[model samples]
Target: MNDFGSLLSQPVAQLGASIFTLGHVLAVTLIGLALVIAIPVMAMRRAARAQAQIAEEAASRARLAEERMAEIMRAQAEMQGRIGTIAEVFGSRQAELTKALSERLDGMTSRLGHSITEQTKSTHENLAKLQERLAVIDTAQNNIQSLAGQVVQLQHILSNKQTRGAFGQSRMEAIVADGLPHGAYEFQATLSNGNRPDCLVRMPNGAPDLVIDAKFPLESFNAIRAAAEEGGPEAQKIAAQAFRRDIEVHIKAIADKYLITGETQETAFMFVPSESIFAEIHENFEALVQRAHRARIVIVSPSLLMLSIQVIQAVLKDARMREQAHLIQGEVSRLMEDVGRLDERVRKLQGHFLQANRDIDLILTSSEKVTRRGAKIEALELGEPAPTAPESRATATDTAAHGRLRLHVVEDGE
Candidate 1:
């Protein structure tokens, strides 16, 4: 602090000097002028430096802006490329989806069309079958109606005793004719006891004939049925008793007329034409059945009579077959002998064929030897000069005969 004060006092003391030289004044003025000029020059230089710094800064800012713009433009270009790629991918996917949708639609259409066609065909076939079945049902309905009418007519015919008996006789005759051969059965045949039966079946092997009586007592049975339907219990009882008596009388009459010891079967069949009447007798008239059975009389319906005829026919057929069995056996024996002779001839023929095969094998061996000799002669003629010898000059036929002789000699050696 004292040194700074002394320096300021020196400048003040110099200024306060009384004696003033011209050189001192001139030096002071020059120094003041130099300071003034130097001050202005420094200020100008500083201003110029400031202006240059501002210009460099402005240039740097301009370059940075340009680089930022370039970067932005590059980014924009990359974005555009990515956007293009995305658009292309979207377009390709759309095309694939469209193609897949189209193929699916086509497949679905084909399947639906096929399914509809098959369903239509099946429906048509079902309709056709239904129509055929309806036609058949209609025909069956018509047949049933006709059968009902026939049953009504049959009932009317059987209502009368005479017609019912005639029906039974006719049915018995028809069955007899159908089941028995032409000469085997006789209708209304006369027996030795001066009694005429409805039908008689002759037996084979001198066996007794079978009598089938067609007359059946249906009057009392009809009365019983009518009384029961009328709700008259007493009348039903009386009619049932009369029916029993009528059945017994008819059974006894058949036994007396048909049961001949030397002529007819021990048991005779009494034919009941109506199936209902036959069922009634068996169901309600057990005592009568037992009595008839005791008398050696077999009661039969139309169906049973037919079955009995068939049985008789079968018996006759069996008897005839028994009579012919010996002839069949003799013929079969002769056929067997012929077969044995044929087998022996076949064996002889097979042996002859085997001998022929052996002979053919020997002929083949001889032919092979002849072929080999010819081949040797051919090779000698091709590769060597011919010898001037008589054997070599021999005719072709002589050479062939000589080869044959050599083949025969070879076979003899073997």
Candidate 2:
């Protein structure tokens, strides 16, 4: 501190005489004071201006922010109004959509219900038809079973010779009865030679009766079939020979018994009821058929016998028509005579009618003349002047002439 004061004392002593005048001292003090005051005032003014500028910027920002806030509020209010309107519209549209969907659903449900009902009814009808068809199939199955049993019975009947002969006889008789009229054929009729044939068909025109024999030799044919099936040529040949012999003998018996000279036909029928046996005979035994033909014994199947019966029926019908021809002609002649008598009666009636017509015409003329005279009498009025002598005479003469005309008409009518 002493060193610092000494340093200052030295400077003060050195300039004390020149530098320490009262005016210099006063000026230095005043300059120091002015610098101190001016620095603070300038700093205060700059701070105030900076604060005012900051306040202005803050006020401007606040105003801008308030405007932006007001705009935001208006936008929000407008958006809310638009949103409310959109909400109302959406609510109405949603209600309409719901109502439309309900209507569509109701309609769809009703249609679906009707369709289901119809489908159910159709399915039921189809089921009923299927049931009816199944019932028909069941009935057919039952019929087929019955037919199978009948076939077995037929096989049993065909096994025995006597039964087989009766079957053939029955079949032949059935064909005859179905084709020919009653009394045209007789079963088991005894011929003049004391031989009873199986059937006797009365031929037309007083011709001899046709004979049909029904017995067939089936045993030998069965044996031939069995031997053939057994696979031995020699056995089949033997069986075939036996069959041919049996057939020949049967044909000879039928020819001898049925072919009567004056009573029966020259050719006799040998009825074979089974078409298969007949076919087998014709196909495999041609010689036997030829032999039977030579013996005047025509071997006929059931179909051929039926055809023969039909021919005989035609012949009988023709003969009956021929027999009744004279009677028919007589009836026709009597009818024509009756028609001629009726024609003569009609001509007489027509003459009577013409006379009546002429009488009616005369009566009509008389009535017309009377009507004209009445009209003339009526025309002579009481108020007018009476007729003179000449007119009166003329009227009297006209009346007399009408009276004569009426008399002539009456006479003609009578």
List model 1 lDDT by residue over 186-227, tens digit each: 887888878999888899989898888888876777888899
Against the hidden true structure, what lDDT does model 1 obtain? 0.68
List, residue by residue over 125-180, the lDDT tens digit for candidate 2.
55565565456556555644544454454344334344333347788887787567
TM-score for all models, in order of appearance? 0.41, 0.45
Off by over 4 Å in 1: 1-166, 334-414
Residue 369 CA error for candidate 1 (Å)?
A: 26
Q: Ten residues in a row with the worst lDDT in model 2?
A: 157-166
Per-residue lDDT for 35 in model 1?
100
Once superposed on the true structure, which residue ranges of model 2 sit more than 4 Å away at CA? 1-167, 320-330, 355-414
Estimate candidate 2's RMSD in Å: 48.5
